[model samples]
Target chain A: MSTEDILKQTPLYQQHLSLKAKMVPFGGWAMPVQYESIVAEYDCTRHGCSIFDTSHMGEFFVDGDAVKSGLDFLVTQPIKDMPLKTCRYGVMLNEQGGIIDDLIVFRIEQERWLIVVNAGTMEKDERQFQKFIRPSEKFANRSAEFGKLDIQGPQSRALLNGLIPDIGQLAYYAFDHFDLLGANVLVSRTGYTGELGYEIYFSWDRTPELWDELLKRGARPAGLGARDLLRIEMGYSLYGHELEENICPLDAGLERFIDWDKDFFGKTALLKKKDSLDQQKIICFISESRRSPRQHHRIYDQNQELIGEVTSGIFSPHFKQGVGLGFVKKELAKKGDTIYFGDDKNKLPAEVVSRPIYKQGSLKS
Target chain B: MEVVDHYFYTKEHEWIHIEDDQATIGISEYAQEALGDITFVELPSVGTEVEQFEQCSSVESVKAASDIYSPMSGKIIEVNTDLEEKPELINKDCYERGWIAKLELNALEEQSKLMNAEEYRNYLNTLE
Candidate 1:
């Protein structure tokens, strides 16, 4: 059989097809890349509300003590001190200090937790959890049973408030269970897009109905294409792009999310590599024009010497130019540094800028 | 899907409209549709010589970048400079205003190697 025949499909697949979405294979699932033009959807996500089908991501339920169940030692964050109904973002690392996956830990209850991970690393992440936690009915991978939708924009709160009257009470990164479509649904005030948004998790079978209702409620449907552009504009790291098993969080400039006060899987190795002088760090750049720097495009210094490689890039709709993230030698990873990207024959000049090239987001609004 | 009748097309989904010895070239509607939204177009320099089926210009969309090959050998006489600021013209009208470059033909017989509109429509069917 062909590889496409074995790919997984979400409950909203038929809905996306009906909407004339362009489908593509991503991380073992047949997902929608775009419904209409990416620029149109991107504008709606920034100025208005747009709903996204994020069912391809993996979700896990863990129950027990934070430290005794090995959950505290598994992730590189302070999970034990998290308030109930709040979420924290961090990474899980291998023994050698390489990142395994970045994930979000949601404290559902005093002893119960919810972990959300990338779709590509779902199986491996499940194994890592099972291997560490004590064998019991305390852990379960519910990715197949749940479907997720993100309604994001400055107007998202008002739009969703019509359905859930108490949605406005939740702070950023906070979550609560509410009755929707006759089923208990978990809704969080968080999103990948740099906008006011809410992520809703519901039963897989009911996702199609949820998608339809959102569209009917004036929330335009957006796909992965717009999602990628939104995240890139916010300087967010995606799995297999800005992050991977071979890259550490510190080098990715995610040191703020790492909890150094606690003992974790890669704590010792990360400590030894902390003071390394020649470590490379992730840097952000803005192109001189609409020409974008693509993945694997080599970065060049002022002297025309190869310095690094681009990991993620996209034409910023807000900035009206190309912006990207790349890894470079620590000494060269400075703001206001001039760099060039692309091949020797077509070296496009760009300026290194601080992260989040589009800063005037409604994320905090 | 929008193959202009009487126009000659290449296997790579490019179309050429010939008027005597001068020919205009652009990508087909199928090509533009496959490339979500045209974000940028790197047009070739005017007066540069190009060979048939060789990469002359390149186009970028939100998804990826693709090389636009010349349909017939010639020298580039004119290019659509409007695409520099508004590449979406190609996505909006891949057949008419979206024409990439105009070439002064160097070979007339090479047109025999290309497919007519009807043949190109049939060729697009095989892809599906």
Candidate 2:
């Protein structure tokens, strides 16, 4: 509550307060945690269409050739294979291979790219880009000038098609600029909820005008509470949680995103660490009971031996059971291994299955 | 929030309905609403003895896992096993069908420390 004076407010801050949202300090911002209830808001995102204010996320524009601007070597995922108007998910890493942040690079123009990063690591990510980006290339951190909104759920496509006629043509991981309400907005067919949706980046100052329009279109306002739950159910990686400065992409189960075929930042470190012994890898689990695995809760084996720690967790409303993502010793992280969460006082039983505990989703649909 | 007039309440938001030496216990409506979408309930054993205001069983909702304290000291007589697979009953009917446990009162005088419906209503206001 004391941080209210210092925390930055988005353009829709007043609107959120008017709706009686439960505001919380997130990533140094006074953001809405939930407008109604976390569960109700989550249900809307899964079944019905819901709009989320994600303007706090970072966006930077780069104008130059991929390799010439030093963008290719900066991220782990390969950029040469991406066609125009497509985006790929990857991570920026430190020299020691520690994950700086997970991001999406959208190749909008032939020589231009739009990169989106997490809200918590925006400043640090910008500093890294400014440090590595070479001369003769144009770069702009337009995070402050862009307001992002994600409309997600099974009903998202139909609702958005009513606004943008060509929304159906935009494939997953693709984007296009369109004139909407007399404003040029960048709409991407990508979302974190594992649902059929779009992430719209609008002009920051005039976004509230569009937010009002979207509300009239029957998109209920969801909050960060629902967003977190949705992403967790899909076993998605969050910056501060699954992908931290101390954690590497390999340990985070994101090696598939890394391009070993091409040389990039932290390549030598990654190559060396790949063969290192005793490395812990991230794994997803489902609780036998309804006891949700909370952050920082230690993970133990069936014998009560300590293995690792839980990074993200929630009681999945879709599954009617607890689901969580955690990092455990790679050797002990088996598909059917029974894991327990909690410390000495107690241990909640769970089983390590394949990644993504929630099987029912409309991500690709 | 639904508060039974005849029930005794605790500061931790648990309620108990006493009939002779037998008592039924469950979390209050305010508690259920606060911990939305109850997912799992850890029912206490039948013969366990519990102290007033002490930890009896725990319930996990989508928001959090909270300790359900004993409203008054007693020996657990029976538990609602139905809650194991139908924990949403805590959210649907927390007062009646969602009752957690039944206890045989060991010390009837311990009830004095609890609040009546009127007193509990006032205490709930102080929380806000």
Candidate 3:
């Protein structure tokens, strides 16, 4: 059988087809890559507003004490201190300190919590959670019961306020249950794009209704193509690209999200590699032109010696240039260094810059 | 979709408009549509000799990269420099403004090996 025949479909599959979306296999699901043109959709998301079907992502509900349930030690972040209605971003690691998946923990209440993870790693993450959590604690994979929509861009607030009047009260990284289209659902002021955005989790079957209502409210439909570009522009780490099984959070430049004050899973292994001299490094760069560096593209130093490989790349519509994330040696990844991508036959020059290549985004505004 | 009449096409989806010994080359609309949004186009340098059915340039989209093949053996005399800055022109107008290069043709008889407008349109249907 063909790959598409075996691939799963989201609830919004028909809606995407009606909009002429180019469906591509992603994370075991046949998802839309683009509705119209990728650049046009990207422009709409940056300057106006766009809604994306993020239902492929997985969500789980864990009920018990943070420490007693073993949830605190399963992830590399401090969960006991997370206030109600707030979200914390961190990674789950194996015994060897390798990243299993980067996820978001939402403290719904003092005892109830929600964990959102990548679609590709959902099964593996579930096995880890199931093995670690206490037998008395309740664990449920609610991915099939829910559908997610990411309404992103600067104009998202005004658009959402039309439907949910109290949306403005929720601060960044905070979530609350809100009534939408007669269903009470979780709505969070969070997004992957570096924009003032919100993510809505509604019933799976009724998601098409919500998607239609959002489109009817003047929000355009964007696909994973534009979403990838937006996230790359923000220097966000993708699961398969930046975070991998063999790569640790520290190597992925995510040490800031790790809490040293709290004891967590993989702490011992992570501490052992922390002070090592040859720890691998991840860097972000901006291309001199529109030519983008693709994943697995070779990264070379000024003298033409190979140093690393690109992990994620995109042609940034906002910056009108190519921006990328790559891994290089610790000694060669200094800021303001000129590096080249691609092979010797055709090398493109770029500069190593700080994280978040596009700073003009209204992320905080 | 938009196959220019009187133009010859290669199986690779490259369209060649031959006028006497001078020819112009561009990707077909079908090709551009399949590529989605074009971000960059590597234009062939001027005065480079290219063989028939050989890669002369490349186009990059948001998804992937693909090579553009020459339909006939020729010397690349001129290239569309505008594509360097705005590659989306190929997605917008693949037939006219998106033309990749103009060549001084060396083998005129090689045109018989390519498909005409009707045959190319039929060829595209097979792809679907």
Candidate 4:
């Protein structure tokens, strides 16, 4: 199908076009790939402030007690204990233990919650929630009613504080209701770029005004191309690439997010496969040269034996080198192991390193 | 999309300026703008023999990688080493400082297959 037919547009579509952004199809959305250049935008986000249009992501609102609403059994995290005005990152899994999607749960109030999910998996995620939580009133899929803008960088908090003073009090993984441009909105201190940033969820129609105001405040416009690079530099997994239908949370190096004490959809199958040694493993690597290892590129050991394949790769402007995250055999997931990444035409040497290759981030600051 | 009057162009968006038996080669401005911010370039080794319209080198932008094709059959006399550290030169000055390679022309007749400034301008119009 044509991208124009399947892909959706966000409220900032006109704004991106005004900046002459390079548009590309991403997650069934007509998203901007870059404004000036990906490298330039990446550098801007690392040093100054950058704004991203994240309105395509799905948002759901459910109203009930945490346990009584079947919310605790739907996700891998213990959400009942989450404080009001706080957000928790977790995953939703299928009965076979495979990941459905990774999501963030926002505790808006004692009886109200907002769940954000990936754009591509919105329909499936909504269906799964509907099937499992047979509530008196169905959970509201409010994805279309809201627009998301992410302001990220070292100076992100200060830049946003100048616009909305109350946002400065928000701690990491916390959110609060604030007034901006005469509208009450939800602002959260969370982001995917491993930078000190805030994600603002506002009324859909007000996005144009917010976009212009943020730009006037000197926030550079960043597109999906730089967004992917920024996230990969932090070793964050993209939904389809690193986490997929056949990949379980444990194999994806997300065991900490899964709570074994509570019962969930994929709990039984995950427990059965927990101790097994034969599983595809997720690992991060850094290239020896500036050459990047692209997605689906074959990863080999020092002896030239094929072991893994890259899921997401990019030339990190922050480090001036190439970094990638991929899945490999469990035996090949050791740190400090030498590896090769390439296609049939060329092969480049690399080293398995710890996740989040760029360590000097202001994410927790 | 600046096309020099004296240069000959290939369908792959490569431009060549031939003087006597030597030629300078680089991607067109249209090509560079389409590729976006070039981060890396894999240059061919000196003395490598290349055929007309064949792939000689590779240029990688942050978004994707593209093969740079040779406009005519020749032997590579020299490759641009400056691109290894600053591939952005290709985006800044594609025609001059960003010249990818110098080829010692072997067959002068291969120039007939390329388009002149006016023909290339019309050729680009067809693409749009």
Candidate 5:
């Protein structure tokens, strides 16, 4: 069979087709790349509002005692301190200190937890969870029966407040269940874009009704193309690019999210490699012009010396330049360092800048 | 899908309106639609000599980049400087306001190598 025939389809596949979305293969699923222009979709999310169908992502539920079920040790964060309605962002590591997946774990209740992971790594992550989770623990993969929609932008709060009651009360990274179109939906004050937004998790079959209602309420339909650009602008790490099986969280520039005070998977290995990180380093950078540096593009210093390779690159609609994340030699990963991308023949000038390149984002507001 | 009747076309989706010795060049509407939101256009420098079907300029869209080939080779006499600040004109109007460059035609015989309005439209149909 061809690629499209073998790829999975999300619940909103027909909706995307009806909207004339340009479908592309992503993470073993046929997903929309764009319904309109990518730049317009990006602007809608950053300035106005946009809704994305993100049902391809996986959701796993585990109900048990944190310590006895080995849930605390399976991830690299302090979940015990997380409030009931809050979610924590962290990674799961292999025994050798390699990243398994970067994910968000929601403390839905005292003993119930919901884990959100990347769509491409869902099967592997499920297998790992099944292996590490205690046989006595209750574990279930609810990815198929769930549908997700990311409503993002500066105007998202007011728009959502019109639909859900007391939506304004939930702080960032907090979530609550609400009634929507006769169905119970889990709405979280969180999103990938640097905006004041919400991620709505509703019943899989009822997703079309939700999507149509949101669009009817003036939310533009954005696609994965715009989502990738928004995440890059915020300097958020993406799986299969910034995080990999051989890439540790520290190497991916995510040390702050790792709680070293607690014992977790790969603790000994991480400790051994932490102080002696002499080779690998990740850095955020910006191109001097609109010429984008694609994935795997080689990074070089002013002296034409090889430094690193680009992991993610995008033509930033806000910055009016190309921004990217890359990994380079630990010594050369310095702020304001002038570097270049591509081979010596077509090297594009760039400057190493601080993370979260787009500072004007309404993410915290 | 706007194809100018008086213009000659290339298989690469470039169109040239020949007026005596001077020819104005721009991308087709089909090309602009495929590109989806042109962000940057690298216009060729004036007084630069080039061959027919040679790389004349390049464009960067929101998604990817593509090169524009010269429909007929000649020295670039003038370039659309307005595109430097506003590349979206190409997406707005690929025919009139979005012209890429003005070339001093090398030879009138080169027109025979390009397609007319009707031929170009039929050519586009084959692609779909």
Candidate 6:
């Protein structure tokens, strides 16, 4: 299929083109891969402010009391206690204990909630919500009605404060309604990149204006390439990679998000797997060599025995090294173990280090 | 974009500079620009024999990996060891210092099958 035929365009598509972004297919959307260069854009995000078009993500509105609406039982994270204007990060699992998608739940009001999901899994997520949410409760899939943009970096707050004076007060994981360009929009202090940033959800029709306004304020345009690198540097899992239909939260190192104390889908199966898990999905690593271990690259022990495989790998611009996220046998998932990655033609030495390969982030600041 | 007047070009964006029985090879500037910030370059061993248009080496950028094809059949006489430590050199100067390998040409006649510098520039325009 032609690039435009299979890919959906965001409101900022023209903007990206205007900036000479390298556009590529990502999650069935015509997304920008880079504006100037991936390394340059990555640096811009780490050191300055960068704006990303995240409109491809799915957004759903759930309206009702948490328990009465079946919203409380649909996700793995505890949502009933989430304060208004706060967001919770968690996963949605199938009956077999495999993850459906990792999602973020935003508490917009006492009876209203907004759930954001991965772009590729939008249809499935909507179907699952429709199937499980009680018919008596009111909800709507508002994915098409909203456009999302993420403004991230150490200078993000300073940049955003120029547009919305109170944006600086929204602490990490918190969100609030603010007036911008004569529209009341939702701005949340949360991001995939481990940088102090905000994810803005605005009216779809107003997105082009917001995008232009942000660029006018000196926020550099970043593409999906930089986004992937930024997230991987933070040890964040992409949906299809670390979390998939065949992987459960327990094996994916997301046990903390799963509330075993309360009932939810896949709870019983997860409990069963928890007892028999031979391998744990964890973020393991390699050195700063330019040689990156790509997806599905076999992970081997010091003795060259295959133990795991990389799910996501990239050359981190900030660290100037190769880093990856992968799953390994439970015993080999330790932080300080040595490992190697192998492909058909090469076997490179590496070491298993802690997640979030680059630690000096402005995420909380 | 820097197609040398005396060099021959391949559709895959490789360039060859032939002098007598010896030929120098590298990817075109357009190819390097498309690849973006090359991080790793897997250079071929010095004595490796390669066929015309065959994959001789691999180049990796932050986003993807691509193979470098031989523009002519030859025996690899010397590989660019500088790329082992500085792959970005390919992005900086893909035509000169970034040349991937030096080869002893086996079939000099194959040079005629490749495009001239002006022809290669025209080919790039057609791609857009």
In order of listing, the candidates' clash counts read 0, 0, 0, 0, 0, 2
lDDT of each: 0.91, 0.89, 0.92, 0.90, 0.90, 0.88
- For model 5, residues A1-365, the per-residue Cα lDDT tens digits are 77546989999999999999999999999999999889999999999999999999999998887766678888998898788989889999999899999899999999889999989998888888888888634889999999999999998888877788688898999998888888877999899998999999989998988999999899999998899999988899999889998998888988998899999989999988888856588888999997887788899998998988999988888878889999998888588988999876789999899988888889889
DockQ scores of the candidates: 0.73, 0.55, 0.76, 0.73, 0.61, 0.76
Off by over 4 Å in 5: A2-5
lDDT of 5 at A358: 87
Could you give the candidate ranking by lDDT, starting with the highest? 3, 1, 5, 4, 2, 6
The digit string of per-residue lDDT tens for model 1 on B1-128 reads 78899899999999999999999999999999999888899999999999999999999987688999999999999999999988999999999999999999999899999999999999999999
Tell the DockQ for candidate 4: 0.73
Per candidate, native contacts kept equal 0.54, 0.71, 0.62, 0.54, 0.50, 0.67
Ordered list by DockQ, greatest first: 6, 3, 1, 4, 5, 2
On residues B53-93, what C-alpha lDDT tens digit does candidate 4 reach at each position?
A: 89999988775778999999999999999999998899999
TM-score ranking, high to low: 1, 3, 4, 6, 5, 2
Residues A1-365 of candidate 3 have per-residue lDDT tens digits of 98646988899999999999999999999899998888899898889999999999999899999998888888888899899999999999998899999999999989999999999899999999989888634888889999899999999999999999998898989999998899899999899989989999999999999999999999999999999998998899998898998998998999988999888878899999998887879999999988898998999999999999999987877777788999998778688999999976989999999988888887778
CA deviation > 4 Å runs, candidate 4: A1-6
Q: Taking the tens digit of each residue's C-alpha lDDT, what string does model 2 give over A1-365?
A: 47436888888999999998878888778898888678888988889899999989889988888988989988999997799989999999998999999999999888889999988788888888998787734878989999999999989989988888888898888999988888778999999998889999998998898889999999999998889999988889988899887888999999999999988888898888899995889889998866789889999998899999999888887777788999998899698989999889989899898867777788888
Clashing pairs in 1: none
TM-score of chain B of 3: 0.98
> What ranges in model 3 sit over 4 Å off?
A2-5
Task: Evaluate model 2: give its TM-score.
Answer: 0.91
Question: What local lDDT score does residue A312 receive in model 4, on the 0 to 100 scale?
Answer: 86
Q: Write the per-residue lDDT of candidate 1 for residues A329-356, one digit (tens) a residue.
A: 8788478988999987989999999888
> With candidate 4 superimposed using the best TM-score fit, by how many Å does residue A122's alpha carbon deviate from the native?
0.6
RMSD (CA, Å), each prediction? 1.2, 2.7, 1.4, 1.5, 2.0, 1.9
Please identify model 1 stretches exceeding 4 Å from their true place. A2-5
Docking class of 6: medium
Off by over 4 Å in 6: A1-5
